[model samples]
Every structure is written in structure tokens, then in C-alpha cells.
Target chain A: MFGRKGKKGNYAYTVARVKAKKSQLMGDDAYQKMLMMSLPEISRFISETGYSKEITSMTGKFTGINLIEHATYANMASVFTSILDSATGELKDTLAADLERWDIWNLKIILRGKSFGIDLDSIREDLVPAGVLDAEDLEKLMSLDVDDDIIANYGRMTGVSIPQSVVAEYKAQGNLAPIEDFLDKHHFERLLATIDSRSRPTRLYQEFIRKIIDTINLETILKLKLEGIHGEPVMKYIISGGKDIDKKLATQLANAETIAEAENDLAQLDMYEFIKDALGKDTHSLKDIVAGLRRYKMKEASTFSHLYPLSIIPIIDYMLHKENEVNNIRIVARGIDAGLDKEIIKGLLVI
Target chain B: MAADLGMIMIGAGIAVGLTGLGAGLAEKDVGAAAVGAITEDVGLFGKAMVLMVLPETIVIFGLVIAILGVFVLPNM
Candidate 1:
């Protein structure tokens, strides 16, 4: 019912409805209870919970974690497409353009799979299967014997200049970083692009993205430190638009006595406070921290929509929030397969 | 007669009252969101309370105009 004038309500309403569903996502208590159940029990639990319809329809064909993983992917894609279908105005266009980043991700994963000769079916399973790129287009690209345009496609999709620069790098190196870089550049640029300056509604949205970019930069820097990659090279990989985590600053942090101290330094940056809240001094596990950060990004968007009911903010918010819930379910399913403790797996969840 | 000024005063009062309506409209979303977050976790009660009430600033702005309209404007 809420949208900018003359624009269709479908996208915004769907966004709101999906947000209500997102609120129903499993909490800590639910995860604790889930740990006490078996795979079949977990499947039943999901069916009784949110994925009930998908589970029942796909029943007898799949079982256990496999069933939930596939169902979660399907439900997530269905929800996302519904949002896409709901688009009405420039907001619709913007959401679609932003969503193209997923295709960039899919292309990178496909190309990487090829470089390693991983099976096509396996790689396909990893993709979101939703977004601007059509299934036929992906299938066509996925079948290319040569590497997927994984890099140039991002440049084209995001309207960035990197794909051309990376084309030669792709051919000579056969590494996926070039295309991946284009996607990275595209993501930050799109987030900062055409920010609705007049709308008070858009300010928090901007700050929210700044935090995501800043965290990604922090994660990259941390990875570099652990990998022992020194300043210049790691600096080259640093994505722009982050509050401050560029090479010189990162190098300064790298020289710190420990990761904790480095993070403390980052926390001192006014813009980098989100990182501190999501992660603390060397206490949380890396996987948990990353997942938490990812979830945090989605939740921040959700929070935005709630505060400012106008604009396309809520739609994007629901999109990310729903994606994380799907990811969490997949993680729980996978963890169960590996026979890990329920508490440990739950601990890793961002919820 | 100065009766025209009385009409102007009433119109101003109505507009001033609307500021409260606008403030309440804004709080509708803020309050819902804060409670949503709180329902997810009881520990969030404190932070959510602060955030939910944060938008009360709008009402305070409205109230300032309201008081000025009564005491200050009447004297003027």
C-alpha cells in the first residue's frame, strides 16, 4: 500500500509481506530446539515452520539436509522473483540493476568452477537462481568451454570500467579475480550511485551500505594479515568507498601487535563502529563473525524500512533479510550432515 | 474591526496542531520497528526503548511552536 506516487504497489507490498515472514525466522531458542532433532525431524520442523509448503510438495523426492537445502534455495528465489515482479517506478529499475550483482556473483562462481573443472551441476546449485539474468542466459554462459565472461559481464552489468582492464588479465592469468573485482567495484558504486539526497529516508540507507563496504574491506585486510600478504598487494585489492580502510591505513593496522589491536584501531574511525559491534576482540569465530556481519547488513536494511516506510528501502531490506534466513537454514542443514553439535552450529548462525 | 485577526489566529492554531499529527505519523513507524526488534530479543529492551522514543523530538519541535503560538504570539 506504501510507495512513491504513480508507482505500482506490488513491489512495495511484496517487500512488506516478505519482511513479516522474515520476522518469523528462527531465533536462538528455535535453533536450540532444532539441535535436539534428527535430520528427518529437522525436515519436519521446517515443514511445520516456514518451508512447509515447499517441503510437502517436494516430499518423497528429497530427504534430510538435502531436502531443506534445495527447498530453501527454491523458496528464496521465489520470494526474490516476486519482489522483482512487483517493481513499478525508478525504484523498480534500481532494485533490478542492483540485483544484477548476484549474476556477477553467479558468473564468478561458474568461471571459478570451470578453472577448477568442478561439475556444472554442482556450480549451478550454488547460484541464487534469481535476479535480472535469466536461467537460459546463465545455462548458455555456463556451457561455454572457454571461461565465462565472468569479468566483462560485471563491467557491462554494473557500468564500471574494470571489465576491459581485466579482460587481458583473465586471458593471461585465467584467474577469477578480474571479474570478481569488477563485481566488487560495481556493488560499491551502485550503492553510492544516485543516492536519494532529498529524502531523509535515504540517509540511513547510505550509512548502512557504508558499513557493509567497510566491513568487507576489514575482512579482506584481516584475511591478508593471516595470509601474510603484505601492504602493496593487499592494498591493490582494497575496494574503494569504504569509510577509510585503504592501503596506508591498513598497513598501519597490519603493523599492530595483534588483530585485536588492529580492529581497535579501526573502531576508532567514526564510520567503522559497526565492525566493532559485529565482531569483538578475537572472541568470535571467523565463520560466525562473517555470517553475523552478513546478517547485520540485511537487518540494518530491515531496520531502515521499519523506520522510514516510504521509498524502496523496505524492499531492499526484505531482499537481504530473506536471503540471510535462507543461508542460515542451509548452514543448519549442512552442519547437521557433518554431525556437528546443535549448539555449535547454532552459535555460528547470525540469528 | 480586528475580528479578521481572530480568524487568522484560528487558522494558525489548526496548522500548528497538524504538527503534532505529523509527529505522530512519524512515530508510528519508529515505535513499530523498535518493538519488532525487542520482540526478537528481550535484551534489546533498553536500546529499542531509546530508539523508539528518539523520534519524540518531532513532538518537542511541535510543542515549541505550540507554546510560542499561545503565550508569545498572543502577546505580540
Candidate 2:
């Protein structure tokens, strides 16, 4: 919704607060302690940390992993909301676009929930309104029964254009993947378009985004490779505007008959080193590969933020770190609940 | 001699004024970030105070130049 004109932003103040908040996020030691704790014990431990307020408020309503999951979503939404509220001018615009990932996430949840006839309250619990969309907007979406009407309302509210053909395909096949892919691609495209790359810092920010898009595209290809589906299906999910891993490379990686061939193609890229170990392992899961890619993205963000502390990179870094923290806690809680081994749980964490 | 003195005074004024402006610009960013840090953690107030005053050195240097011009240059 923001225009292309660059305005003065409160980067110093916002980034400082963000960095302080980031410093308070849980570290490896906390994760280790939580991994050894029981479900209730984990809940208690989480209650003692940043999520205390969220957990205490919901204590009577939910418990165990369910409580942890919902409380994390609540905490995430409030955290993002407060940050967005505090930011001014261009910074706020960039953050809103970046956090729109969560909007896409909430949209996916609503779509999936409505399609499968899931209960409204539980789906609401799963929704993290960390994006531009607020709880009220989500409530309106939840009240709508038809997917098309919900999508239409979302477009009107957010000003995001969803092609009729994509919606028609989603309707015809009853599949949500295409819709999800389109939304994600559109979000990144919008971000790139709104950014005027004339300034050096913004140019760096754009480069950072391109790197992330590349990693995401790589992750998608690896996922499709593992699923034994290739060619057209994999190509359909490829997002445009990446630095590397364009259509040609993506096709080569996707159409490779053997994983080794795909690895050979990937080895030529700079990012391959970051993910090589994950890809080379005999027992590689898409989860492990994705975690590796995410770590690299985090690394890139940190370096960029350090290089330009006054830029938007620091805020993006803080956001990524906070999201990782939430995801890590959820993983530990859910892993314990599922009776998964401790080592396995450790493997799944991006940290 | 009086006109020369007047010019020297004007030069001194420019030195101090421009430097003061620069210092204010520098401190605007630092002070803003410092307050932001302090809000998140009260314990950081002392550190923030130190950083917030760091930019004051620029203005101090400017003041010294102005002092030199006003007190020493004329005497020289």
C-alpha cells in the first residue's frame, strides 16, 4: 500500500529496540534445558520466559503442546504488532511487506481450515496475525464460508492482487499449494517493486531479499526432488527474481535423474557450501535441508545488518531471529510430546 | 584592522556554528538509539548515556577552534 517515494525513517530507534529485544531471545542453553524437560515442565519453563504473559492468560483454556503453540502464536503476533506500531515511515512500510509472510501464512491457514471443514476457534488459535492483517480482519475471513469470497475480501483489505486463473485452478483441483505459491511470489514481487534501489543501503536490502528467494527456490526444488516429482510440477513452484537458481538452474536441479547430479549442479553456486553437508548426507530429510538453508539466510541477514546497522537489515535480522526462537521452542515442545528422540529434535532446530 | 577583526569573528562564528550543527546531527542518531536501548533495558542507561555524549566531542572540538580564533588568533 505504501508509495515508492522514500521518506525519513526512524531506523536508529527501531533497530536499537529490535536489537535489544533480539538479545533477550532464548539461546542454545535454554533449548537444551527445555529438551530435557517434560511437557508440563516445558510449559512452566516457557511461562518463565518471554511467553509468560501469553501462557498465563491462556492457561485455563489450553495446556501442553497446544498451549505452547497458541501462546507462541499470540506472543509472535503481539511482538510483530508492537514493532510495526513503533516503526515510522519507510521502515514501517518495509516491515509490513516483510511481515506479510505471516499474512500469507494466515491466509493459508484460513483456506486450509475452510476447505477441510475444520473448527473456527482452533484455526484461529493457529493463525498468527503477525502481518498487516489484524485479528478483526481474520475474524471477518473466518466468518466467510466460500473460499472465493474470503480471497476476495483479503484482496480488498490488503490490496494484493490474486489472479482469477490461480483462484480458478485452486477451485478446480481443490488444492491450496498453487494459491500459497502465488501469494508468496506476489509478496516478494511487491516488496521488490516498492523498494527504490537508488540508495546504497536499499540496494543491499534488495540483494538480501534476492538471496532469500534463491534459498527458498532451492529448498522447494530439493523438496520436490525428495518427493520423486520433477519437471513441470517442480517448475510450477519456482519463484522468479532470485539472484541465482533461475529457471535454467532450477530446471537442471529439478530434472536431474539422481541426487548426485543435482548436487553437482548446486556445487557451482556460492550458497551450496552452506547447505552441502545437509544435501550430501545419506539420510537427509527435507526438514534438515530446509533448516540448513534457513541458517544460511540468517547468516546473510546478520552480515548485512552488521554492514549497515542503520538500514532495514538489522530489523529483518531481529525478526528472523525472533521467528527462529519461536519455531525452536515449538519444535522442542512438540517433539517431546510426539516422543521423538532428543537428538532428532536437535537436528530439526535452525540454531 | 577593525574590518579584519570583524572577518576573523565571522570566521570563528562559522566554525562553531557548522560544527555545532554537525554535532547535533550526529547526536540525533546516537541519542535516539540510546533512548531506544534504555527503554528495552533500564540497566543499559549508563551505557546509553556514555554513547549519547560521545558525539558531544565534535561540538567540543568546534568550540575549541572558536576559542582559538577568538582568544589566540587576534592576539597572534
Candidate 3:
């Protein structure tokens, strides 16, 4: 998928197909209906909707939550693969780059699982295998015993290796923070590098990427503030290339004496406006705040996707929506199986 | 004025031919998108047909101009 000659994209056909697929995504009403159903009924409903293939393939081996989880992962992987397959030229490159985050995601899962002494089987369950790394690649990564070995092999596999120093830090401190931070930075930096700024669509795509970087940086700062860590360490986790939160602004935000100060500074940015009210509310978890920010990003993506129907925005929009759909379904199915309250499950959804 | 008549015929041909090409170019993208949508949802077949044929009007306009050039202009 690399070094393709033509930079042209099949925007019209891809956008139309994606829009049709987007329309088929489950709506709020569907989620509400699912919320009320039992696990078996939800499973039946989802299988009938489109996941019948995945569901039937894993029939006897897995049941209940396992069945739903595995099926959703398989379905999402195939959908993502189909999307990448459907595009041509530069569009495919951009998508393949963006989707590489899933590989990083799977890596993170494996690292964390290995570090925490979780077994390979359970660790495999959380992986999406939606990126360049397929099940076999993940299986290969999972086979290695040492975390450092996994890191080295991952670097060789994807070519975005964490530095030996960071790996050493991870080894010494037993904290995956530095290494994870490196992976996040590598993901965005690689995306920035892959895109050329000449075309309008790509420039807009860069803006989208910048916005994502900004939000994630903001999220990292907030998480650090919550942990009560301050000064130089806070800056370490911040990813650069954000539109508003550039390196200078990031340093300033990091150097701020208190979390409240950071929040006040964040309140000035227009993108942060949506989450302004709930910034430091005691009742809300970091997950809620992050989810709120993600929802805002999705809204921005949706608006832009409509404005530029024949651009990369629509694909990004569809991908985000699809990912959210998968997450929402998983949440509902798992929540139902776990006997969680309907209101609680609804609260977790990004809709 | 055999030469003048010949030039008028050439002009008529050029108008129809160029516009037909333009219409075809315009329809290519739309037709692809339409087919894609139709594949995703067969229900969109009617809507896709409407959108796909909308470009045909360009060809019709070209045809009108060609007719005017060939038939009416000489009389004028």
C-alpha cells in the first residue's frame, strides 16, 4: 500500500458507498432497544442485523458476552479492511496510515497485558486486529515472553519503534507511560509525514489530525493534573502538531501551577468550549470527560464530512462512527450481560 | 457559399460532439457513485437513476444547439 504512483482518489464512489454504510449504522433508537433486551436477544438482534457471518463462525466455541465481543471485533475488522480495500491511491494511503493506530492500540494492549501478568488469551480478546497487523501478527507478538522482546519485534514489524531509552525506562520504572506516550506521538507524527499539504482535501485532513492531536494532548494534561503530577513530567506526554496546543502552548499549559490554571487556559480555546463546564467537576470520571471530548470531535467530523462530501473527511467520519457503533454495541451487550443498569449503559455510550 | 455551409455543419458537429463528451465526463463520476449507492441499498435504485440521468440534460442542451446551428442558422 506504499509508494503508489498515482495520487488520485476515488472520492465519489467511496464517499457514496461510505455514506450508505454510515446510514446503516445503528441509531439511538436501536441502542435504546438493545439496552432493554437481554444478552441473548441483543445477540440475536445484532446477528440478524449484519453480524450473522461472524456469529455463525464462532457459534459453539463462544457464547454470551464472548460471542458478542468476538463477533463485533471480527465484524469491525472486516469493515475496516473492506474500507481500506475499496479506496485507491492517496486516499488508501491516508486511511492505512490513520488505521495504523489500531496496531499501536493492539501493541499497547499486549504490553499492558504482559506487564500486568494477564494471560495471552484474555489479552487477545481486547485486540481489534483492524490495522496492518492481522491476527497472525498479533499472535506472533504475543508469543514472546519479555516485554522488551515484544517492543523490539514490534518496532521491526511496524518500523515505528520506541527508543531503547524509553524501553529501558519502561523496564526500570515498570511504567508503560513513557513507552505508550512514544507510540501515540509516533502514530500522529507518521500520519503528518505521510500527508502532503498541497491538496485542499489533504490540508483539511491535516487539520482534522491536528484537532485530534490537540484533544488527546489536552486529555493527557488533564489526566496528569488529576494524578497531581506537575512540572517537567507533564510535558513529556504531550503530543506535538496540534493546531491550538503547539509546543509553546503545551509547555505553558504543563508549567501551569494548578489543574485549575490549566483548565482556565484550556477554556480559552474554541474547541475546548464543549467540555468547559465539566472540566473539574468532582462527580465526573476522566473517562466521561474524554468521552465528551471524543463526542465533540465526532460532531466536528460529521459537520465537515457533510461540507466536503468528496473528501477524506467522509471516510474519517464513517470510520469514527463505525468504531463508536461497535463500542456502543459492545457496551450494551456487556452491560446487559453484567446486569448493569440501563441508565448506566446509556451513560457510557458516545451517541 | 458551399464553404459557409460546410463551416456551419462543422460548427454543429463540434457543438454536439464536445458537449456529448462533457456530459459523458460529468456522468462518469455521478454514475459510479450512483452505482455504489445502489449496491449498498437496492432501494436507492430509483434515486440513483434520477441522479444518473440528470447529466443527460447536458447532452440534450448540446443537441438543441446543434439543431439550431444546422437547421435554423442557415435560414436566418
Best by lDDT: 2
i-RMSD per candidate, Å: 6.0, 0.4, 0.7
CA lDDT, every prediction?
0.66, 0.87, 0.85
User: In candidate 1, what are the lDDT values of residues B1-76, reduced to their tens digit?
Assistant: 2675576567567756777677666666666555545543566678767877776776677666666665576567
Deviating ranges (above 4 Å) for candidate 2: A1-6, B1-8, B73-76
Candidate 2 residue-wise lDDT, A178-212, digit = tens: 79999989998999987779888899999999989
The residue-by-residue lDDT of candidate 1 on A272-342, one tens digit each, is: 54445545644534674566557656666767677876556777776776777677777777888899877
Model 2 CAPRI rating:
high
What CAPRI-style quality would you assign to candidate 3? Answer: medium
- Model 1, runs deviating above 4 Å: A1-4, A7-15, A56-62, A148-162, A244-251, A254-261, A269-285, B1-76
Off by over 4 Å in 3: A1-6
Clashing pairs in 2: none
**What DockQ does every candidate get?**
0.05, 0.85, 0.78
The whole-model C-alpha lDDT of candidate 3 against the native structure comes to: 0.85
Ranking of models by lDDT: 2, 3, 1
- RMSD of candidates 1 onward, in order: 8.1, 2.8, 2.6
Native A-B contacts reproduced, model 3: 0.73
- True lDDT of residue A167, candidate 3: 82
